[model samples]
Target: MELLEGNESRCQNMFWMNKDVFIRLCDELENIYKVKGSQRISVAEKLGMFLYTLGEGAGNRNVQERFQHFGKTVSRYFSGMLNVVCDMTKEFIKPSDPKFKSIPPEILGDYRYMPHFKDCIGAIDGVHVRATISPSNQVPYIGRKGIPTHNIMAVCNFDMQFTFACAGWEGTAHDTRIFQSAIHNLALKFPKPPNEYPQMKWYLGPYKCQRYHLPEFRRGAQPTGYKEIFNHAHSSIRSVIERTFGV
Candidate 1:
């Protein structure tokens, strides 16, 4: 791809003869492969795997073919690159420490609903991501867009920031189930839950923010749902998550 984009030499010069971060990353990777008796593989070959799979999202055989230009030996180099980048991103891309304090709903920016939904901390929803076909009851795995995929649940905050996401569950799972799983894993993988809500910080007005969780509404022992006045505000703000993901 670098070559396709008119930067092939940059890739070769850095990976081949230069000593830099990629080299260090490759050395660190060799140690990782060593546990599996993969010590004999070259750094370049490991890099090839990473480049082929994640960089281009190519299948294994396609990756093997792509490495032919670099000489098959460099394929392992790609694998090293993929592993290092994956490990790095997982550690880095995370939900920022979200304050319970909420902001005005103007962020929706001329979105159908406005101020009434202001106190919402973030929008939440699920989307489908392509996955390998499965053999069991095939219809459930078939997507409305006519593709084979698993229903990946993901959620974004008011800022369109991907605050939560999960992939691997079968499409059969309900939105509520997917949401619960995402939150549980997010809590364990990250920090403690906040004791307050963001809207608590925003000053009240036609555009102030408010947040409500259905589970909270149910468990709080309220025989009725939220108050009639609150019902409109909550629904308006809650739709943000689905809209953000284009669900």
Candidate 2:
């Protein structure tokens, strides 16, 4: 209550978003998701508790102390909030244009990638998220990072919204394997580019063993040849997925 009623900075600091967004989220949860408030607790308080735990990575005890509630109460609302948010993914995390009818504004408006990457639809990449599994079964989930994690493959348009996501793959699984599995799985309904262009390619990758990373070219090492120039442009355009993952 205090956090939401307080200034914008306090709400942003604790909830990881401003007061208006927080209130709007609470409203959406109640109106659309049918989340209800109990006799003693309001919906905003429940949501604030959930956001505090997530934004701070705080444990149940920390949430209990901060929210002034019992451990069980905090656990119940946190789990409820988590489930509600997951359900919302179906509604929010999708391509703005299901048909891929035209080029995205983010790409169309940018002269650097217009003509060259005209056929490019979006970016695809994989990220490793830490996972908790039994010690006996940890080997399969341990990748080059030497940690148990999940390799999540996701596709996002230039606007930085996830159109598709394939999770639950072990960290050791190769990106190609996960990608192939995702495309082959009809149930996933992965978006496919329209056939307007007969020479539609699945994806474009940088030149092999070449200067690709953005930092490499940023340090006064300008791309010299055609391959290096193409790779540099490709990396610059495809960096949206990297930024999305960073967020």
Using all chains and alpha carbons, the TM-scores for the candidates as numbered come to 0.52, 0.82
- Per-residue lDDT of 31-126 in model 2, one digit per residue for the tens? 999999999899999888888987887888999888799999999999998899888887887778877778778878889888888778889999
Candidate 2 segments whose C-alpha is farther than 4 A from its true place: 109-111, 130-141, 146-148, 195-201, 224-226
Per-candidate RMSD, Å: 10.4, 3.2
lDDT of 1: 0.54
RMSD of 2: 3.2
On lDDT, the leading prediction is: 2
lDDT scores in order: 0.54, 0.87
Off by over 4 Å in 1: 1-57, 69-86, 102-118, 134-140, 143-146, 185-193, 196-247
Candidate 2 CA-lDDT value? 0.87
